[model samples]
Target chain A: MNPTACILVIGNEILSGRTQDVNVQYIARRLTELGITLAEVRVIPDQRAVIVGTVCDVRARFDHIFTTGGIGPTHDDITAPCIAEAFGVPWSVHPDSFRLLEAHFPPGEFNAARQRMATLPEGATPIANPVSVAPGFSIGNVHVMAGVPRIMQAMFEELAPTLRHGTPVTSRSWYALGLYEGALAEGLADIQDRHPSVDIGSYPFRRPDGRRGVALVSKGLDAAAVCHAADRVRELIERLGFTPAEGEPP
Target chain B: MNPTACILVIGNEILSGRTQDVNVQYIARRLTELGITLAEVRVIPDQRAVIVGTVCDVRARFDHIFTTGGIGPTHDDITAPCIAEAFGVPWSVHPDSFRLLEAHFPPGEFNAARQRMATLPEGATPIANPVSVAPGFSIGNVHVMAGVPRIMQAMFEELAPTLRHGTPVTSRSWYALGLYEGALAEGLADIQDRHPSVDIGSYPFRRPDGRRGVALVSKGLDAAAVCHAADRVRELIERLGFTPAEGEPP
Candidate 1:
């Protein structure tokens, strides 16, 4: 069975387009490399009710849950407490995180805004932030990280070595220039039927010279199956009277 | 009242991390510029059930709903029918869209795969696609468009004229180098309190020379108020013994 995960991106800045969410793609790519199936991703504003409802709903459905953004010191940053409420846990200043914050900004400098970063859910394990002192936390199966791409990436890299991984899927692709998708439909369907475990996708690409081509990609847990399916795709393209070009992996 | 909008990003490739979602940011930025508050963004796999559920939910919650991706001819592309099902509309070949598709891919070549591009929900009006012949459609307040950045931008440019826009919000950002967020805490709080209607945000940037700076951004519907607040930010930065840079409009 595939180990599935869901990501909840919490921030009003993201929804307002003030900030482009870079963490989702970073996390998704990392999860895919680890063989974890990222099933869904939801971006909700910093509103408490929405965040709480989405966290509860997604946590119930997916095997693992990851949330990015809203764990900062600002008033609009409400993800940590809301997520704690969703899990019915008490929220407090985590000792370890507080120590880390203290190390960065000593006593007099540690005001309300800086202190806010230390607050976390009860019984949560701190996810180390190599880039910044603001630590992320994990409660139950939910991993809450920072919104900033650099910080989120650092936290994920620190967390990755400990998580469970499934069999990594491999993919191969071939390109057919100036060939219509309709012309290869029947043969493509036949190849798909032959390889049940393999997933074949046809991506239409427009060349620099204005020629259209279909890049057929085959993906499967078994590398041999992926290779075999890709070979069938190449054969299908040739049968349709088009010479297949060696495709680059995307 | 704030005009609200929600974005539904539909694709299996996004969930699988094969594609990073860029359309959400494009839609969000454009909507925000029109003074439409983007309340939510949902990224779901190209599954009928999930798409329908999300579309129905978002449509109920927001003033306008915008969807991207999964309108292509591939088997995994399922956004149109799922949206139709959500609104209880019958799927049919739109005459105008059919003509457009036919014009792009002449007579005999207009096979099943190409034909799928013309399908739309009943009573839907076609949203012109400047980049591609396969046009997106709109039903009531929901605008459906392509996922490709260039295509999505083109579709939005076509649709923008028809959209009802609110008072556009203006923003200005003031920068201060080598100053920590902790140093500006008291002054930032004072500015925030003084301008409740305007949103003040502090974005920390690590310079190429390894210096840390905070870019304070002030936003509001009133341009004069935004400028006034930005001036206050510059004053605060100067008062703190830092060389304040002129606020750039954002």
Candidate 2:
């Protein structure tokens, strides 16, 4: 069985629609490449109880739980302490993280707020941030990272090599303009039935020129099964009198 | 207290990183405009147990639950059935929806696969889809809409008027180039303490040209409190020797 993962995005900004989250997609793609099945993604507020409750819930369910945001030096930056509380561990300054953050900042500038970033749950190891000095941390199965895309990407890159791997999920797709989902659903279902190992999904799209189409995607850990399903999807498109393009609809 | 909402996104395409979701943000912004608090957003796969379980879990917690995707005419379009199961209601074809969809499709073109789109839970009301003829539905407090942005937008517009509203959440923000969060976190916390009603968030950004900055945002249902907190944020930026610019960083 593949290792499963969940991204718990902790932020009021995302929930408020003030920030369009690009973090989940980036991490999802990376987890797919790493062969980890990203089972779920949750965007939640920075409220401490919610953070603590969700972290505890998801950590027990998934092999890896990655949390993003609320690790900064501000009043709402409550992820670290909340996480510590979740694990029933003491939240305090990690001597190494404190030293690193202190050295990174200039003289007399490392205030209490900045020092908050250096605190982590007892026994949690820091996930290095290549972009910024203050680090993210990992305790048990939960890996906490920054919300900013660049910083999160950097932290994930530093942390990826340590995760358990599975067979990377791969996909094959065929799309055609002028092909509607209603026209193709029966054939697609038949194809799906034949390829039980492959997951078949039909996505409908409308191009910029107002043309509608459907993209039939076949995905699985088995490359051959995925390809065979795609071939069947392509055949279905052609049999329905439409030319199949081997990608997402334009 | 404001009514709370949760958006449940159901699709394997999103988890597979094949699709970037714009539905949540659109719904979130609309809900915020309608004065509903969007407390959470969950993206889960197109699996029956997970869907039914999550739907039941969230529906009990929030005043409203908006679900996107898996309402199309394909094998994977199991959201209707799952939702029916979630509510412990009978999953069957609604006569009105059935006739509407049957008329929309050409004769004999409306196969079993297409007929699935017309099916709904026993007590559900269809939400009209202006972009496409097939309708989305609402049962209890859960509003199910299409995953496609255009169709989802249309469905939400139709459903919004019926939802209970509160004082619309509003925000005020001031950003300054070269202002670091570390330098401003202390005063921002002070401002946040003074305005207990407002939510103060400090977000750091790096311009493409490598200049770092911070945007201090004050959000609340109380317009005056939000603005007052933002004014303090602006003053803090000035006190730190950076000119504060209103709104998000360019």
Candidate 3:
């Protein structure tokens, strides 16, 4: 089994519908490529108690935990302190991180609040922020990164090389055209049962022209098993008299 | 305080990053317009125990709950039974729903799997699914809808009128170009402190060309208070020597 992971998105803007999150997709794709199974994702508010509780809960369950948002310089940037509290570590300033931002900013520009970015959990290493000077941090299995898509992507790039890999999961998908899920359900279930290790999923999509299609995806640690499941899915689609397309249906 | 809701996205495809979810944004926008506050969102895999646990947990905490995905015909579609188990109610086929799908599908098409769409929790009301014949359902405060964006939207439209409303939250935002989050952090904190009722958030953006900007958003049940906070954000931007642009910065 691949190492399991969970993502915690710490932003009220996301839950409030003020901002649509791009971080989850970015992290999910990155972790998948790194051979980690991205399991659960929770979009919660920037509340301290909630953050503290959730971090502790998911840390025990998943092999790796990623948290995005609330790591900025604003008053709403409460993630760092909460995370420190969760680990029972002192929230302190790292001199190296402080000097990095200190030298980058003008003498008078690095105010107390700006310096807040330099403050992280005790013993946590600062993850480099290439987009801006304010760095993210990592402690134990939890990797706390920025919320901005660009910044988060940068932080992930910096952190990716350090992570341990598991057996990489491979996936194959068939775009099932002219297929009703009802007609395909039983056969698909039989295929899933036969390939016990492969995780199969059917997603229905509606086209702009009012046509419907389903994307049948098969994923597993074994590439050949996943491919075999995909073959079965294609055959089932053919038996139902529908053409199975690869990638996305046009 | 506004009537709060939680969205439970029950899809392994989303967790696996196989698909980008458009449902959360759609539901968030709709809830905002209806004067309901979307408090939380959880994107979990299609696991029965996890679904039941999350549903029960959120149901006790929030005023309303909306779940999307896994309500299809396949064996992987377990949302209905899990939802029923969450409420300690029997999962059985509803006569009206069965008749609806029974009539909609051709003679041989309404297989046992197709009929599963008609299965729902005891004492639940069927929400109309105009896009597809398989209807979504509501049991108490939890509204279960399809994973497809189009179908979810249709079901939400059908269910929106039935929900209770709270005071609608109003938000206003200003884009600050050539500004730093560090420069705006203290002033934004001050503004947020002064207008305790409003929620102020500063978000940084990096353009395609790397022209950076920050968006200051203020939200509150009181429209005037939100606008006042937004004005303060604009003034802070001007004081920091950047132009405050309305809407998204060009």
Best by TM-score: 2
- Name the TM-score of candidate 3: 0.96
Arrange candidates by DockQ, descending: 2, 3, 1
Which runs of model 3 end up more than 4 angstroms from their true locations?
A208-210, B208-210, B248-250
lDDT score for residue A13 of model 1: 70
Candidate scoring better on TM-score of 1 and 3: 3
lDDT value, residue B35 of candidate 3: 87
Error of 2 at A194 (Å): 1.8
Shift of residue A126 alpha carbon in model 3, Å: 1.0
Native-interface RMSD of candidate 3: 1.2
TM-score of chain A of each: 0.93, 0.98, 0.96
| Residue B18's lDDT in candidate 3 | 71
lDDT of 1 by residue, B1-250 (tens): 6678888888766776767678888888898888888887888877688888888887888888988987877665678888889999998899989988888876688888778779999999999887778989899888999887788899988888788788777888888887767678777878888888888877666766777787777888888889998999899989999988865322
Off by over 4 Å in 1: A180-182, A193-196, A206-212, A222-225, A245-250, B207-211, B222-225, B247-250
Error of 3 at B239 (Å): 2.5
Q: Is the docking of candidate 3 incorrect, acceptable, medium or high quality?
A: medium
Q: In candidate 2, what are the lDDT values of residues A34-92, reduced to their tens digit? A: 89999999999989889989998999999999999999998889999999999999999
lDDT of 3 by residue, B1-250 (tens): 7799999999988877777888998898888888898878999889898999999999999999999999999989999999999999999999999999999988888899999999999999999999887999999999999998888999999999999988887888899767878887888899889999888888888788878888888887899888888888888888888888888555
Q: After superposition, how far is residue B35 of candidate 1 from its true place, in Å?
A: 1.8
